[model samples]
Target chain A: MSDEIAILGAGMHPWGKWGHNFVQYGVAAAREALADAGVPWQDIKFVSGGATIRCGYPGFVAGATFAQALGWQGAEVNTSYAACASGSQALAAARNKILSGECDVALVVGADTTPKGFLAPAGGYRPEDPDWVRFYLGITNPTYFALYARRRIDLYGDTLEDFAAVKVKNSLVGSKNPRARYRKCFTAEDVAASAMVADPLRLMDICATSDGGAALIVSSLEYARKLGKPNAPRVAAISTVTPTFASGVLEMPDIATDSAAASGVEAHAYRSMIPLKAYEEAGIGPEDISLAEVYDLSTALELDWIEDLQLAPRGESAGLLRAGDTALGGKIPVNVSGGLACFGEAVPAQALSQICELTWQLRGEAGDRQVEGAQVGITANQGLFGHGSSVIVKK
Target chain B: MSAKPLAPAIEGWHTMQVKPHLIGSQCTECGTYFFPKQNDYCRNPHCNSTNFREVELSRTGKVWSYTNACYKPPAPFVAADPFVPYAIAGVQLETEQMVILGQVIEGLTVDDLKVGMPMELVLEALHETDDDIKVTWKWQPLTQ
Candidate 1:
């Protein structure tokens, strides 16, 4: 209804390790979105940027950095940082401004340039910082992922083959996506042959860090109608909720989980709670989702996200994977953009990229990898420090 | 390196004595616990008690989930020069009802551990410094 913001355009700079400044990728993606929307750059009133802390102080003020890079037009600027959910938070800010009638049209953008090898924390004896503590305890990012993957084997009876199949499935479609990186199709044997980074997770099973950017052009329904494009896809909901106190599982960079020992405090899975608000705000359910794009930081995580999104019953995503139900042309096609499997992760940009993929799918323009009759698409992603995000985009 | 005395890597995190238990704080009102010492505030959404007491955690717990680090981690980890991989576990303490992560004691692999198995806390050398042998808490799997 009136609460929703129209997605007039979506664009992305191909995901890869190009070794360029992150600003270039953001500018390129922004220009592409501007061109795609047929909206003049000068017409945009607000620029909401998702931030990547790795890029230094400029990255912290990314909205102004990108605005100045695009030549300032006195447009208002804002920056949001929620780890991987940064993009959704930025989009939510833009949506709020639009709904509040402070501005009719806004640009939502995110970009990143990641370092090579494992992401480690700053040095010194800083027990107060969780990142430093986890690293000191020798817990890297993949360790958490491997823990979840191991649970699939120990509890869900999922095999290493099931985990490898997820990589195989996503890699096949990623090969066809021009915007994706690491386009080579991977085999189960390839995954098996890859060196184990963590038990049950090989090098190929975990996504790499990359430099890429994604952006969106959104406007009020009235602005779209005035532009003679009334049928643009709309963002019905954007949920960026935090975990209830006493998180059930140990999340990234945390050595211990919140204790559920206190009376009346229940430990809950944070991932499952993310999508519930999106479904409520969108007035839709998991059954209504025709497709999904999720954070697959690890191959097994895709399965966990599928269940978390309620796309499948708990511990049953492997069946969907085995039955080819999560691939292109399946009943509920997932990650038609090949997920983080192909894209690795550009952090801030990756979340908005999920939205860009859904926008393309809903507009019936995703050539080769398009899900047929994709009327409703939802996205789920999680990051460190209790960042949980889900968004619904519908025709 | 000169011979040096042994010390807790970060002071007050745990006891240095043999069979050491992790040192944490508990909310005086709600019974919620925190590791790495949290004496400031209670995190229970239901309880906002500002009062907390220092407490020793249960020495033994059950394995909630486990994994290994096949590659050496970056700075602050202080991996050996040759880099030996180590298995890590998330153990659910009986009293805390919370899972804590730590390295499985030396000479063990993921193949040697299973979920829900009992484990006890122990002190091990995290790394050796010129002035001290830095020790941290580790989890030792109990025989089934």
Candidate 2:
């Protein structure tokens, strides 16, 4: 309804370890999306890729890879990598082109064949890279996440049950998703009994790495009408914003905090503000959002996302989960498509895939676990190295 | 040995944070801050002013969270052996209102740690060679 681009089609290769090349998955997803959109690949004026650093050389130039896989038409190609937010950045790139009238139809794709266990930085040692510094120092990813979980326990009085409940709520929804990697239901007991990956978080609490792909066909508002569906799912806003140093949020793969000794401004920490900004630009608030798909790399992280998304007040996300406010049948369902808790993380592709879930929800196409009467939806995720992202979609 | 500029200590060399802790830039007109210290300019889209200053963080804070590295980290991290258990701690500085993460000192395990425990940052040797020793700050329990 607002002046926004239209998501004519959304498609994803089943999210699992397919044991094939990332390009193959990306091509399959792209073809499905193009077919769904009723648009020919040759008509796509621009192509942007959410990169997969996991793929070595071919992953770096994902835009060209997908372009070549689809048969080279010389469309404008760009590949972006923002750790977890790569897919959202790709969506932003495509949307920007359409909004600026530089292109009418754009193809956006993100796919990855992730490594098993803890994701590590690319090979070699150079003290200069913070990621390498942290890893070399034996600072693993879960350790940082545990650090965040611990802080919540200290300052906010959160408990182990609160953390477990996040897995409970998400697992319930994840069981309904056929595309999910682990579709079994979980309980607080199950989470409590799971082996500790980090203090206060267990292996069940963490999302697994996966090999999967997701793609979308975005077009100008005028183009959507020309393609016959005047009322298609529209992308209201795409925000790929990062956090401010004043936030006091020390990110991972870094050895030190931003020196606050010089700047006296107490960091107004808002890593979750970007997504809300996108919602605001879309002229909607959390209450107005019928459902949501958020990054759930860890169960505790998902609760943090709930607070960060402003879906619930600070320190109250757990209560909302207990109240069934964020469950599939709740007033404002979250992760109705099982989120990353079920989907298994595909890295660069995950955030864009969240949008794909939103597109499905907003279009009233989500089977089994759909949020009833869904209208407005949002996808929220953060990428490492200062990438903050959110997207608002409305039917 | 004195600091011999160490093997580019962790690799893919270029920028490294040494004595001065990294901080980001913010727009006074519009509230926006960036870390890894945004050297380019203020990131707030609403305001374009580049009036920003550096801020040093607290050396001491409380442990917000922690986890041990049970698996050997992959490339770029120079390790002599396979994955050994190492602890990572997240510290929350009261003044900054942000949580920072780092490696716990060697020999420290989760059983020895608890949330809300006090921690202080200290620069310790990460790796050492004949000529240079790579030193980086890690979180250590105040009592330890």
Candidate 3:
């Protein structure tokens, strides 16, 4: 349908700690996307970029920062910060602009150069801030991840092996992805041997924070047709939804979940709502999705997201994995781009990177890891402070 | 020579007494409870009740899940010098059915806890400055 916004180009600056500024990575990805689209920088009518809080002032003004870096052609600029979901929010903004005819073609970019060691709160002692409060209470990100992982094991009968298998499967695919940060394939033994960061989650079970970037050039279908590329992959739906009140799910940066006793919980919890909303908007269901990419901040989270994506019945993701249903050639191959398991997390850039991989797979350009006859794909991610996003794309 | 007196890291969290209980807010109309006290308004989407009453949470709850920090968390989180790993748990209160996260009592590890185990709330020192001791709530397995 004409409702789709065409993804004319997708690009990334390899995922790793290069010790360079975030702008350099963003600019490199943007130039590659521009080149791939055969659309000159001056032709871009709008730009939406994700903000990285760690980069000081420039990170906050990412849209203008990237536009100026690419040689300001006077493009309209917008910046978004939804934590890890910032990239999806940026893409959603660009898609809306294209659909509304405010811009025929728009550039979307997200990049981050994370700090070394565990992610720390920005300087300041604001006791009222939940992020700071959690940190002060010794509630690290991995601590929360482990809480959920352990819950899955208790509730779903999932085992340590099931969690390790995810690392093994994703790392194998990551080994083939030159852009991924950790290329070496890992065995379950290797994952087990890694030091435990959080109980039930070993070092390898969690994704590392790294420096990387991803960019996309999107346009209206009519604009794509005018450019002589009629069959480009198009984003059918983008869901950037906040949690319903009294969300029972415990998310990051929050010390307690919303009280379900007051509002009465919805059928879908916070995490499940993102992709379900996208599916409804796309006029499709789980059965229609050819493949999926989801936020795998931890190995157990990947399995949890699989159920949230409705690819498997609740609490049965481990069964799906054991049966080889989520492998490369299995039903609904997930994280074919190696996910955060391999690429690590570049915060703002990570979600957009998922879309980049989907764009290539939908266009039949993914060489070794290509899902044969792939048509529809979905990307799901959740950011701290109640931001959840999902995007559906089709060829 | 005496050590400094202990204080709640953030005030109004709990009472410092023989039996310490977490102080929170309950929506008088909807009957939903919020820990860390939502003093402003009720979070219930279904009801627009601005009226809330402060209530002390149940002393005991079931463990929803638990984990331990094997590495020292970065700043803003004040860990002991020569950091020691600590355990954290999500305990679902008996009445509220809402899960609240807190550090487990000293010397307790993930191995000592299990999902659905009964736990009681207690006050523990989070860290200490030269002049004052910062205290926060912790979860402890109820002794039989």
Instruction: TM-score each candidate.
Output: 0.98, 0.84, 0.97
Which docking class does model 3 fall in?
Answer: medium
Better of 1 and 2 by DockQ: 1
Query: TM-scores for chain B, in order?
Result: 0.94, 0.70, 0.94
Question: Best by DockQ, which number?
Answer: 1
Between the candidate structures 2 and 3, which one is better when assessed by DockQ? 3
Q: What lDDT tens digits, residue by residue, belong to model 3 across residues A216-284?
A: 999999989999989999899999877777665667888987777754556346688888789998999
lDDT of residue A364 for candidate 2: 83
Rank candidates, TM-score, best first: 1, 3, 2
| Interface RMSD after interface superposition, each candidate | 0.9, 4.7, 1.6
RMSD for each model, in Å, please?
A: 1.2, 5.2, 1.6
Model 3 chain B is weakest, by summed lDDT over 10 consecutive residues, at B39-48
lDDT of 3 by residue, B1-144 (tens): 238998888788888885698898998998889887886777676777888899998988889899998888878888887898888998888678688999998898899999999999898889988888988899999876
Clashing pairs in 1: none
Name the weakest run of 10 consecutive residues (lDDT summed) in model 1 chain B.
B1-10
List runs of model 1 lying over 4 Å from the truth. B1-3
